[model samples]
Target chain A: MKKNVFTTVTLLARSAGILLFFLYLGKGIQFISHLPIPGSIFGLLLLFLGLNLRLIPLDYVLPTGSFLLNYITLFFVPVGVGLLQYSDLLSTHWLTIVVSSVISTIATLISVGWLYQRFAK
Target chain B: MIYLYLIATILVFLVSRKLLIPIKSPLANPLLVSILFFIGLFSFTPLIYQDYATANLPFIWLLEPAVVALAIPLFSQIKQIKKQFRAIMISCCFGVVIAISTCLSTALLLTDDKILLLSLLPKSVTSPIAMAIANETGGLASLAAAVVIAVGLLGALGGFSLLNLCKITNPQAQGLAMGCSAHAIGTAKAIEVGNEQGAFSSLALVISGILTAVLAPLFAWLIGIIITI
Candidate 1:
């Protein structure tokens, strides 16, 4: 029971820390520039640098980070559901989406792959 | 009242996971299945998109933390990434440029609207990052997210065939291709191929995402200049 309680507390604390960091960057980005990239992306870079530079303890964020990553898909469900709102846009642009995604995806794969093989040697 | 949406999402996802266990195909991704399930559920039920949004606000907020949490895998892979740092960086840069430019040029030809261009700008990245970028660029975040999902599904399902058709057999190349193009779903497919492929794909996923996040705004600016000219 003691161990379980400790685990729960740790999870909560770590998760709160991660959330706080994200919010921090979100607000900071708002102040800095109205850039299109989300603050979360900057927050990720910050956390990554912090860990790499040993500014933040790995254990402090590891559990919460892994947990959130594991369920990242769940978090996007709302966005997917937002698809309901764009039925018209989707229908009108379905052909473009299908053809473009396919062409662009293959184009990306070939270009990246060719470059890696060309330069890796 | 709002909790109902959460409960239903979890249940549907679990059911979808169980059903896909035997099929073992990338096309049967739990994310796609769950999203479709929820879309169906909302259609039949009295709940509307706004109702779902208001109720599922917490999950939507979770997207921010989820993006931040991406640092963990990236950090863990730092040592390995450092070993091939130059190669990885070069390939990622090339991939991002190719991916964004192709999408942009294609979309530009297909549509005269700027919002659609914004929506497709971030389609190469993961969904959360894509949605965030889309929203910031004055596009519909929902449209971006949906497009990202479809892109992921398409990559997961068709990636291998494309690779084979191109005669690209190098694991690193294959992984980078998938991760750069498909994002997470393609990473999943790469993991199935081999550990080396998985590692490279994960690295590509992170690098491509970061590169897109950093470079997309600049690309938008350049495109704006060109348009005005």
Candidate 2:
């Protein structure tokens, strides 16, 4: 029992450590580029490229990456709760908001899908 | 007391996810359920929102790195993605253009509020990028966050049904559309559909995010020019 607990702790620590390393690497590059893009997205690109280039071994991130992905939605729960802060505005303009979002979402979905389907064919 | 707040957030998420297995309805989305729980806690209980927010710092901090971790699945499908790179790129660019234009026009049809317009402009992008675009375009970042989620939820709920209606059988097409229109939430939904869909969705997500971040500012500038004229 004690050994299993220690192993789980070690795994969690290793996962966070590697991911944080990549995150900072991405932030560093973004800083140098002076682009307005978020560092996390930059980190994603860096990790992808690093894997393709074989600079970062797949095994290093895979175990932790999959572990992280399983809880991906959990990470966003806190941020989504922040939406409550705008409940007042959301209530007042609910009509405009819903109408626009629905129309916009459907329009983009159709346009993008149709265009891609045609292009692929 | 602080422990109760933290435990409540985690407990709600776990129970909500368990409930989702039986419900299978997107409206009962785990994230939505979690958010609603906090809303109820704040409204009915003596528990304060600010304290709850403070307790959630650990989860919030994980968000960025979690995004970074998306590279794993993305890398897993690189071979297939590379085979059709040009088509995917073109589709993503086209999607970006359509997303911004339609969202802006639809919102304009309803209201002429600049902040609302700008907030909805990046509604198709992910949260972090959307917030940045909203801030740059003179919109309320907080409102943009909510607008982005609203749009995401809509796509997640109806994206597959809508794709079927459009006769888009191609997983690539469906994935790209969902990612381009709905961002992360939609991508999550796509991932559940298939691996190919997940990869393409994430690819489209990255490309569309970059495109929107670049083009949204230009769009705002163009709108400003037209508004002044």
Candidate 3:
């Protein structure tokens, strides 16, 4: 039991370290370049390239990735809770909020889905 | 104090997940339920949103690395993904355009506040990028973050059924729609649906984010034209 637990910790630390390194590299590049894009995005691209190049073995990060994906929903709770900060603004402008969020998301979903479904032709 | 807030957030989330499972509806989404739990929980406690936000700072920081980890899913699905790359890119482009236009026109129907309009411009993308875009375009970052989360929640809840209603049988189509329209929350839901969906959604989230960043100014300008008329 101790051996298995220790192995899990080691794997998590190593994988997190590698992911954080990429994340920082992305931040550095974005800082220097004055890019409009988010650093996390740059980090994501770099990591994808690294994997494609075989520089980082897939097994090295797969467990961490799966774990993150599994619980990504939980991570959004805090930010979602940040909704409290704007309750006043939201309530007054409820109409605009409804129209924008509801209509926009539905339209985008339908259009993108419809467009791509036809793309195979 | 901090531990109290952290413990509350985690406990609320875990319990919400467990309780929401048997019900099995997106409206009862665990994230939505937990957020509501905190929002309600706040009214009873001496704490405020800022306190909870501060305690949960680490989770926000984890978002970027989580995004980086998305490369794993992308890598896993790369072979099949490459075959449909162009189609996915084209669909994402259209999705971004649709998201912006619909949001702007609909919001314009009710009000023309520049800051609010600018903030809503990036509502369809992930919160981090949405906030950045909102700030760069003379919008309130805080408002942008709020709107982004709202949009993500809305999509995460209704995106699947709506896609099905539209007869979008293709996983790639469904995933791309989720990513571009819903961003991170949608991607999270897509991951729950299946790996292929998750991979494609991540790809579209990144692509749509980049597109929105590059075109944010144009949308901002469009808002100017929109309100002036």
Candidate 4:
């Protein structure tokens, strides 16, 4: 019974944290969507500010946060699978996708690796 | 119908996770496997993306909050992050600029499709930020999301293997390279490698995401692509 209660409370706390985070994100999006900048970026900034201000305790939120991070790719599945709708665009521009992704990723690896070697001492 | 699809997705994920343990190769990633399963399913069935999206919308709504929750980890590492602020900022600026410009130049030289050009701009960033950039830039968010997943898979599958092949032993270097190039999935792999690598990679992911988000638009504007909105 004790273990059950503990698990329930932990689960409740995590769900609450997730809920609050989304509410905050929605408000941030609404505010920044009007501006020239992107709302999600502003939402991230707001999250950063909120954290630095100690408005949200990291310990209480870490479980939910890590949970989300662990399965971040799962969240992208819908959007990714949605690509089927643009099959024609993809087929026509397959080379562009191939070149851009392959080149950019390789470039990123090289540059970041070099910088890390030079400065991360 | 949509409920059945969601159930199928869950089942596929579980099955893939089990199958992956025995194989334990990069190709066995549950995400990639589940996607392939759906791709095959859609190919044979008449199920449209619209129907799948309608079913998947609830799950999709979770992404924004998950991203917001990334602040917790960032907040916990605040002091370490503060001490290395200069290094982080400088590296991020250099990293973001090189990533975007190289991608843009490569895409432009390789193809003239405006939509393809915009889609590739946010490829280095995390998915949510990349999706926003793609949407704002008049590229298909769905396509950008696919590109983001592909980038992540590539980073996870090849990153550690290549690191071993190249004999790059430094945890910091490994973490930063993974996060900078591969984003969250790379960071996940970094964590599996070691603690220090994971911490640094997570830090790099946040900083790199922010930098890419800010720079991609400016780069687009500077290149004379008039903002459609």
Candidate 5:
């Protein structure tokens, strides 16, 4: 029972940390920058800096980070499902979309790999 | 209540995943299956996309925290990141420039529509970043989002064949290529390969997202110039 209570408290603390970072730090920067980039990206940078500065504890953020990352793909499902609304647009340009993405994806993969091997060595 | 929709969505994904356990295809991602399931429901049932989106807002909001949480893995892998910092930066730059230019030029050749061209500009980045950039650049955000997902799914499914064809053996290079090219979904596939690749992929995702955010407008302007020429 004691350990169970401790686990609950830990979960709560971790979640609180995550919320504060996203709601406060992340959104705050977005409000300031007025750039097209999402606030979460700014929040990520702040979190990284905070961690390096020891302002945010690793133990505090690790559980939340890993937990959220594990389900990162799931969170995208709603938006993926949102794709159904675009059936007409997608079908209209299906050839360009498929051909460009496939060709570019392969091109990127090859180029990055080739550059990294050359530069790293 | 909203909880019902949330539960049902998760349930559908779980069921779809379970059903695909025997299939070895990388294309059978939970995101794809769940989206298909939801799309089917929307067609046959009374559910509308707006209602589903509104009901699922809380879960969608979790994406923010997930983004913030990315710092942890990045921090843990800082040593590797620092060691190869220059190479990583250079390769990511190469990847982004190559990705954007190729997609734009090809789309431009296929259609004279500029919005469609802009939508494909940020396709190499993650969905949120792509959507945000698309909106700012006069592209259709919704179309960009869908295109982003399609690019991710395509990369996740067929990326490895390209890697094998290129004979990319270094885990760092592989992760860099995957993340730079495919964004989050590619990173997911990278993680499945190994921890090191996962770290580099995560790094690539963040850096490439930032680069695309900053450079997309400039790239769009350049595309305009090239078109006029």
Candidate 6:
């Protein structure tokens, strides 16, 4: 009976946490729409404020947060698939995208790597 | 209709997680798995991309708060972040400049599409910052999102492999480089390498994001001036 109760509480907490996340997500969207910045960006800022103010404990939300984070890539699947509609755009500009991405990545690696090596001393 | 896409997303996630463990390679990355799944689905189904996107919109909406949640880790490490304040500031500035300049220069020389150029500007930063930069620079947020994911996947798949090739055996160096360059995806790889590396990498990801957000516009302005002159 004790174990079952514990399980129930945990499940309740998880559901509650997810609910709170959605609530905040809604508020975040609303906040962003009125601002000059993007809604999602605003939502992130609101989340930061909530965490910093201790209105929400990381521990309480971590299970849900981590679950979301883990599958972040999956969230982008639809976007990637949407790229199919832009295949002609991609093909025509393939060289530019490929070259820019590769060069920028290498440049980032070198700059950050060098800086870390220097200051990590 | 949208429910079907959500269901598909959940199914893909489950299958990818199971398949990823056995491969132990970035190629088997969950994001890559989902992307491939979506691709196959799109190819096989007659459903238009628009309908699929409309159904998947909620997931996209989640991107903002999820990024903000990254600040949770940053807040947790506040003390350490404070201690390394100067180093972090300087490194962030340098990282941002290099990231923006390289991307812009390459794009200018290689392509003339203003839209694509704008979209690519924020590719190095985390998604939120990338989206902001794209918006400020007159790019589509959705396009920037695509670029950021592509950059992240490239980093996750090839970062460690590249580190090994370069004989960069130091965990701290590897983690910092990966995190700064690759953001979350690289940090994921960093965690697999070790705890210390993961911690440092996570630190780099946050710092780089903050720095990139502040600097992308300034660098773009400078690039614009140089081009005009």
Please write out the lDDT profile of model 5 over residues B1-229, one tens digit for every residue: 7567788888887788788889877667676778878889898888677878887787678877876776777788888788889999999998999999888878878887788988899998888789889988889888888888888878877777678777888888988998999998787777767777877887898899999998998988987777777
First chain TM-score for all predictions: 0.82, 0.79, 0.90, 0.68, 0.85, 0.65
Q: Write the per-residue lDDT of candidate 3 for residues A11-96, one digit (tens) a residue.
A: 98888888989999999999998877788889999999999999999888876777777888888898788888888888877788
Off by over 4 Å in 4: A2-7, A18-26, A33-54, B47-49, B134-145, B184-199, B221-229
Candidate 2 on B1-229: residue-level lDDT in tens?
6757667778888998887888755577777778777888787888678888888888777777878888887888887788777788878898999898877777777777777777778889998889888888898888888988878877877898889887998998999999999988888778768877877888888899999999988888766665555
In the range B41-148, model 3's lDDT, one tens digit per residue, is 887787677878898988888778899999998998998788887788789898898899888888888888888889889998888788889889999988888888
Off by over 4 Å in 1: B44-46, B108-115, B126-146, B156-175, B183-229
Better by TM-score, candidate 6 or 1: 1
Interface RMSD per candidate: 3.1, 1.7, 1.2, 2.9, 1.8, 3.4
Candidate 5's C-alpha runs over 4 A off are B44-46
Alpha-carbon error at A21 in model 3, in Å?
Answer: 0.7
Which clashing pairs does model 6 show? none
Off by over 4 Å in 2: A1-12
CA error at residue A1 for candidate 1, angstroms: 2.6
What local lDDT does model 6 show for residue A86? 62
Over the stretch B1-229, how does candidate 6's per-residue lDDT look in tens digits?
4679788887887788787888866577776777777877777888666777888888776554455454555556556556766766666668767887788898899766667787888787677667777788677777776677678778877887776666666666677777777876676566656655665676677667767766767766765565566
lDDT per model vs. reference: 0.76, 0.82, 0.87, 0.70, 0.82, 0.69
Candidate 1 residue B52 C-alpha distance from true site, Å:
2.2
Residues A1-101 of candidate 4: C-alpha lDDT, one tens digit per residue: 99999987887587556546555665666575543333444555576676688775556566666776666667656655666776776687778887877
Q: Compute each candidate's TM-score over C-alphas.
A: 0.81, 0.91, 0.95, 0.81, 0.92, 0.78
Comparing only chain B with the true structure, the TM-scores of all models are: 0.74, 0.88, 0.94, 0.78, 0.89, 0.78
Candidate with more favorable, higher DockQ: 3 or 5: 3
- If ranked by TM-score, best first, what sequence of candidates would result? 3, 5, 2, 4, 1, 6
Deviation from native of the Cα of residue B208 in model 4, angstroms: 2.9
